[model samples]
Target: MLWEVDQKVKEAADALHPSSNVDHMQNILQDTLIHCWELLLKRHSATMQIDAKFQDLLFRALDYYVVGRLHEMLWWLVCERCQVVDQLVKTRLSHLRHAHLSALQLGVPAHYYTPLPAAVVELASLASVESAIGRLQCVHSTIELIQAQAKEARVTLHQYKDQEGEPELELTKEELMALLTTVVVQAQCSHLVANIYYMTHYVFSVTEDDPLWKSLGLLRNTLENIMKLDVARLPQPAKSIRKELSLQDLMQVSAEVESRFEAKGPSRSIGDITALDLQLHQLTQQIQLSTQAHSETHLTERNSPSRRSDRTMLSPTQDNSKSHSFREFLSSIPSSLRESLRRRQSQQRSAIQSSLNG
Candidate 1:
């Protein structure tokens, strides 16, 4: 039944739910296939030519239905982010509890104070992606009692007595301000990464056919004016949310173009793909140059934890040779802004150094 779609989606709503398997995710994917089949095969065929009334009515209905669906999806995103936070809390607490128990058993009460040294914060700075950065931020926020190492890898601990008068770590107001800013910024970056990956997969899926790949890639890139996957600037918190939203429109346009070109109606071409091909090539070259600059920057520096993530993530050295879709997308982006991206990276390093020096 069509209601199974809603039921399956409900099951996946809780990311921590035990039954939330890859199969449930597949069910959601299959739900889309089912809808496509129903629309193509089960629906009654149009008996006559499209009428003005039907067209007008359809547009009006879409205005209401589409808006509602957008709100629903947004709510879903909020729920997903909350679940991510929940999982982080559970995981961290589980570790802390184990450490606490171990300390009690060993008769070394000091181990209960801080299980792991705050130096790991330095390690966190090199998180492979922004989403990982965001998830780590959530973990940092939920537990007020933990050692935190700042940018210079110096551990700062604010330990006080708990209800039992034992020592515990805590965050101060100023520290909270910094941590909250990081949490929010990391969350935004994570969302941006999530959307980018989602759009990448969506585009690749639509363009997987023999004749469509090159043209569709160009069409999507043209619509987005994307150069180098725009990776360099994301280290800075987004200036405008709409900037990412516009990139998101790339996939929407790709989807629309796909439905039109592949449908079983009057065959039409969106003109020559030569221009599109040239554009894609130029964009990819630009990104490759940018990626190289980013890599050089990576070699020259290592900084505080928060800043470290951007450094390594900007030019991922791991597994780019793999034929994965996201890797291919990142590797192919043109680096027209390679110099600018490098300059920004330099500025960021300077700022970080200044912060450390201060």
Candidate 2:
């Protein structure tokens, strides 16, 4: 009876009711095994397959059936050893339950185990060989969502065209290009934001600071760089719109990313040159604070040990080193417009000399 039920389960394919049929078979086999000690050796022998060892042969047969093998010929060797069938059923059920729970936790689709009738493929980006299967599952969900949306849009568009005339559906060439550009820019920004948020979150969640934090720091720097680049690249209206939208909300989605990256303070991930200028102002303040606490002279210029001058008075080595470092720092300040800074300083010095002469 257990063997017959197992055969039926195999034939059912996706329709297999393991909860009812499979469990029932396992229980019947377990009860039979518990009572079979009183039976004659010949009576029990008739139940066993051609193999001399009844239980061992049944185990091998049951192994073939439980692992999704549907054919009956593979189990001909152990037809009556109920003990093997019970173990196989228990093992299979345990495996299935584990897989189902894991899938549910990972937001996998319900039919995750119902293998697609196609050749299996692999992805290079998959974390491991096993992840290829998970990625395929993600792809399946994405495709389903896309299909549903496309179908709904098609129906709505057809109805709109019928009621409003085909001419109303067409857009001007410039309008179409503008719409496309807006879409492309938004898509790119969204991708960058996602990368920044995840990378930041991954970095701060670690207990011991790993080199991965450097990678995260690089990402944060890149985000700052991109924000500047975008500000410089995007049109004023678009830049204003982005500022109005609040880029911090994007970073704040993941908790760890939010904790590591402050939305307030002087540093901002995106905006005008003014925001970056504010950060530079803060750095200059820190430098002044350190110098006031330690250095005797205002322009001691303690940058490199090799470049440090022995004389308390300014020397070419100290002056040149300070000038070089200041220039290097100013190079990052785009709007300071170096030529203007040079001319304005020269003008100020002339004004001071004129006052001394008077």
Candidate 3:
């Protein structure tokens, strides 16, 4: 049914040319295509798997349709049909394929299985899926390149727009699209492919005393440092706004900015914003060190006791001395309730002294 309808639509389209009577021919072709789509949906609804496969087919097929606009159209269609799946599957199918097997074995669907680590199997499943997103760094680089190119092109075309004579041929929408597509493809090829390999090694290249794994472990502490620096260096938005505003507007501006002020009221300084960025870079180094330490600590915890005891047993005198020392340390400590009360009293005294000094 679909094939016959598609044939009719094609025949109608073939009968028309750019210079021919397009209006009548387009109406006929549109009717044929709409009818074919309706029949296709009817056949799709008749089977459970057919409906699923049709969704997949449309999802993949539309990528080649009208330079990627149809993919969004297919998305709306799937949404209307309530066919949304896991976001990991939808957004990061490539990364999801590389995710731990635990993710794959999650749902109790009939087709689900103990996943094997075969890129081929994952690729087969994803053959009908959209292309994976390019890396962020790639997009960043591409934007920089495009801006640079645009600036250079603008410089070259500066005289063309000023001419008062005949109009120059403007770049067609298709031509501009083709140029942007080239840039996107180049960005994906250059950065995303390289970064994927690097990221894969970072995640999976575990070994004895692996430096890469160590670096990843320390990242959170580095982030903490970054946050501290960022808090300190953040621009005093209110002060800058105040400086730029007239006395008349300052009153209204204060009212507008009041809601965003911190507990201490708006900042009256712009000491340094770059320090935050610098600290972030320093944090990366700290993160690397921390990661190494954590991995080393974990490795020690896993293997330390066995190695420590593998040596000659301690002498009875040494063992007794160690045991005695531990008991003495425990006994020297005050009770938890007493310790808490003592610390609270010390804090209260310090607060009172500070208040007196102030």
Candidate 4:
């Protein structure tokens, strides 16, 4: 089914452009995905063995699927589905929690495992399940954290009225996405993939139409799409309004600013107002100059490397002096004698240098 879908999608796509069908690199990804799916669905214990192979195929597919903003589209689709899964999983887990607790309280073991009398065996099974659950929970937390960050990101992407009172985007849409952000989403998918691999050992003969198989199929499609599409051209939404801020707390500051702009002397003359305006203009220039100077100082400090007093790289002259001083100290020893031992290190150094020069 995976192969048929990919093949038909390709044929339909290639029908428009004849050359599109000639991409030999495309087969590697499709072949690997199909092979992995076959392993997972039909064979026992082989799916786990070929996980690295599946992951490798997905990565290599990146080179082949360099068209139609596919990478960007796949990530967006994957994240959307992942977000959906997160909510569903959370709700499912909440409902299942009491049942699980009650089971533990009643001293019941997890179903699908061979019942044994040994205490150690039961504990091991519980531990294994706990560990697996921990991994899934970690992935859940990652998705939640990403969701929280995305809310703030949406705020940042909101249309803001600029100083000119014209709507402007604070940052470009491209700048909003971090390069490795997709990797976090992929890791979440991998967590599920691994759990499924573990589960397949007990469950037998999952039909192609099974919900579990369908989800895996969808995930595989997502991974495949991530490889081929042109990620750069994914459509970005127009900036939207978040909220309007018209706080009453700014009244005092607003009044002060109005007073500055309209300040006058004792005489209700135009000249006094003119003088005040000149003073305000000079103050603005002074502020700009001060800000520029501070910025330069800050940049210099940030770019310069910090120096340490205790340890530092020495000059060749310093190294030569240190060696000579150490030789002098060694020469002071009676048993060591004067010249030979003292000059030994220096001679060796000189010989090595001469050899390199020669």
In the order shown, the candidates' Cα RMSDs to the true structure are: 30.3, 34.7, 34.0, 31.5
Clash pairs, model 2 backbone: none
TM-score per candidate, chains pooled: 0.21, 0.16, 0.19, 0.20
Q: Scored by CA lDDT, what does every candidate get?
A: 0.32, 0.30, 0.31, 0.31
lDDT of 3 at 321: 51
- Order of candidates by lDDT, top first? 1, 4, 3, 2
Query: Ten residues in a row with the worst lDDT in model 2?
Result: 111-120
On TM-score, the leading prediction is 1
**Model 1: lDDT to the true structure:** 0.32
Model 4 is weakest, by summed lDDT over 10 consecutive residues, at 108-117
What is the alpha-carbon RMSD of candidate 1 to the true structure? Answer: 30.3
* Model 3 CA deviation exceeding 4 Å by range: 46-358
Clash counts for the predictions, in order: 13, 0, 3, 7
Residues 1-358 of candidate 3: C-alpha lDDT, one tens digit per residue: 6457546645654654544432343244334433444444445434532454553344223212211222233233323322222221122222211221121122211111111123222222322332211122223333344334433433333332343454323433333232333232222221221222222211111222443333222221221221122112233222221113343453354443333333324442322222222223344456557767887554222222222342222211223453344334333322122333335434543453343344
Output the better candidate (2/4) by TM-score.
4
Residue 320 of model 2, lDDT score: 42
Give per-residue CA lDDT, model 4, range 140-252, as digits (tens): 33333433434433333232111233323232222212211232222223223233222221112222454444433333333233322232233322222111123232333
